[model samples]
Target: MKILVINGPNINMLGIREPEIYGRETYDDLIAYIKEETKLLNIKVSFYQSNHEGNLVDKIQESYGKYDGIVINPAAYTHTSVALLDVVKAVGIPTVEVHISDPDSRDEFRKISYIRQACVTTIKGKGFKGYIEAIEYLVKHHS
Candidate 1:
């Protein structure tokens, strides 16, 4: 199986933007952790991250028939991007939404997730491990 991992907005600022909530692991560290944890699962994983909403939408559109499933952390966009939600629905790929912190437990503004309506599940508060959980969920259920 193949999975596309998509991150949005300030996600590239992991370990720097807000360590109190996002943790001390750099973005590269998170990537390495995902790779290491999933290497033995026999699934191919591809990653794409952008602060630009359009670029993220483009990537999601480009995935089309190219990927079996998607794991997305829309970050700040999760609260506002109806476009992301729409594209995910349009593409019709099995998608899982992930977050390093539990949005429901955060600020009131962070409680919303526009893309959740289009996803198979939402994994939050498990930190980087949430990505692995999402990948594994897709492997077990979507495949």
Candidate 2:
């Protein structure tokens, strides 16, 4: 099994921007954590992050036969980007939405997510562990 991990917009600033909500882990730290977790799983994984919506959309659209499952943290795009959602729909892969902080506990705007309409599993408030859980579930359910 192969999995694609996509992170969008300002996620590259994870540790520096908000230590309270996003935690103090740098993007490299988070990537290392994901790599560590991936070692025990029966899948190969690739990770990508971009501050651009179009790049993320393109990456999602590119995942079709190249990947089996996707673990995505659409960041701010989760509430706003229909284009990103459309690419995910087009790819038709099993996806799990991950949030470092619980969107429900944040601003009202964050509470509404169009991506959730398409993805059944949303892991929130667990920090980087959400990424781990999402990948594991994808392995159990898809791979």
Instruction: Return the top candidate by TM-score.
Output: 1
Candidate number with greatest lDDT: 1
* After superposition, candidate 1 runs with Cα above 4 Å error: none
Q: How many clashes does each candidate structure show, in the order listed?
A: 0, 0
Listed per candidate, the RMSD to the true structure in angstroms reads: 0.5, 0.8
Q: Give the Cα lDDT of each candidate.
A: 0.96, 0.90
Q: Give candidate 1's whole-model lDDT.
A: 0.96
C-alpha positional error of residue 40 in candidate 1 after TM-score superposition, expressed in Å: 0.9
- Misplaced by over 4 Å in model 2 are none
Q: TM-score per candidate, in order?
A: 0.99, 0.97
Collision pairs in model 2: none
Predicted structure 1, TM vs. truth: 0.99
> Per-residue CA lDDT of candidate 2, range 1-143, in tens?
99999998999998899788888999999999999978978689999999999999888888889999999999999999998778888889999999988999999999988787677599999999999999998999988
Q: After superposition, how far is residue 140 of candidate 1 from its true place, in Å?
A: 0.3
